[model samples]
Target: MTLSALDQLKNLTTVVADSSDLEAIRQFRPLDATTNPSLITAAAAQPENKALIEAAFEQARAENYENGELIERAIDILTVKFGVEILKLIEGRVSTEVDASLSYDTAATVAKAKELLHLYQSYGIAKERVLIKIASTWEGIQAARLLEIEGIHCNLTLLFGLHQAQACADAKVTLISPFVGRILDWYKKAENVSSYPIDKDPGVQSVKQIYNYYKQQGIHTQVMGASFRSIDQVLGLAGCDLLTIAPALLEQLEQDQREVTAALSVTAAQQASVIERPVQDEQSFKAEVEHDLMAAQLLQSGIDGFIKAREQLHALLRQSFGLDEEIKA
Candidate 1:
């Protein structure tokens, strides 16, 4: 059989599974994996993972954790637990996000990230093997900057525009995960257009622009195009430093035997010149997000959605703990 598209893409770009499903990841064998509060909650709801969820809640109870805070810690433990399971099937690192509620609080984000990393270390996983995922907000980028200084790598996520990517690269982040599908989603909805050519897709264009800019500036940070909605978006960015694809889309690539080709590269990027780099200071970051209502709305909604997902996971753990409690509002 001809090499599957997934296998061919691996030749030019590192394919990271954007899921918390161990079985799916085991089958694909992606070099690394990424998880968010939403993905983890989805995994916890699975019947096969019921025991796993209960076991984690029991451990939290034994530790004398009570009330909502108990579930909070359990959420952290569950995130690491999933990471540990993923690490078992892959040799590369895993990216676990910090609480979305802390997206604007640098200190809180830093502390929560440290707690998560400590949780992973307690499980015999090296800090080097984990990327503390954070929002691309200025505060989050600041937290990532400090984290990097301490040898803890980070993946700046939910990035939409060139300014966000510029900020992440300036922060010396390990990787930036720009949302390709999300960008395309915004344009398609905003313009009332149902379909766009792959080459003309906003999401693909955004990643390619960032990739070219990064290479032009000699920035060493890696670009991982993420949140893809279709195969064209994936194939469009074939030579990105990495692509964190969902398992369903990955399975599609596995089933299709199309020959994948590299479309972005450092050598090709050398011929590309960016118009002007965006200023990404605190004031500029806030201003940029405010000016681009699309970016502002999406970032806010993504944060709110992730926060809700974490709370839902907490409620699930509480149910398994023989208690039904509400959020401490």
Candidate 2:
């Protein structure tokens, strides 16, 4: 029998399970995995993941032997636990995000990223087995650029514009995740419309433009489409470097036996879009992104959401340690 859409995608794209639920990852067998603070908070609340959470605290107790220290330690412990689990199944890297509270602080973002990598290394995880997830702000990109030179790969998240991709490419980061569903969400809300063309969906268009630009410039930074609102959005960009899809949508793809074909190609990119000019510098890039309302709001909102989720996770850890969770609140 011919391959299903999911199988065909497996051939073209590095399927990434975008969830903190390790069980869901086992079900899909994605080649990679990604998790944000929000997903980690959600997963930690579940009954199944409670053991993992408790184990984190236990491991922390073994090290620092204090409630506050346990809480701090659990953050690294739980995160690496997820990465370790996923690494067992996937051949590629697993992305664990930095503390969202540090997104605006380039130095802090770089510090926390190194801490995460150190924890992974302590657990026998190779440096190549991880991609430090960072927000695509100017600070985040700068942090990633520094780490990339140290042999630490990065996955730049919350990317919503061509400028973000260009910056990341210039930084020579390992990968960039363009959020497809989130972009669609923004355009729909702005236009007061219910639907739009799959191919022309603002999110899809954003990734396509970034993808073409990268290929045209011969930038090796991978483009991974994320945050899909529907399978149609996922199907719309079938040949991206990677697509960190949710488990529910992965199931939908597995069940839908539709014919899948390449919607992007190097040949077409070379012929159609020419990078006749040099990449934008920081000043112009920042100015250009500031002019785009949707990108600005989405980028800020995405960062805010991560910060809130990180606060929630910290609250959970505090409560788990019999500390004052309200302080975290």
lDDT of 2 by residue, 192-300 (tens): 9999988679899889888888888898999999999998888888888889999999999998888888777777777775755455777887887799898899999
- lDDT of each residue in 1-329, candidate 1, tens digit only: 68999999999999999999989999999999999999999999888887777667777778898888778877888888999999999989999999999999999999999999998898899999999999989899999999999999999998988888888888899999999888888889999999899989988998999999999899999999999999888999999999999999999998988888999999999897754775668898789888998789888888999999988887777777677565552
- Decoy 1 TM-score against native: 0.97
What's each prediction's TM-score? 0.97, 0.95
What are the runs in model 1 whose C-alpha is more than 4 Å off? 327-329
Q: Count the backbone clashes (under 3 Å) in each candidate.
A: 0, 0
Q: Estimate candidate 1's RMSD in Å.
A: 1.3
Candidate 1: pairs in clash: none
Best by lDDT: 1
At residue 187, what lDDT does model 1 achieve?
A: 89
Residue 38 in model 2: lDDT:
92
- The CA lDDT at 103 in model 2 is 82
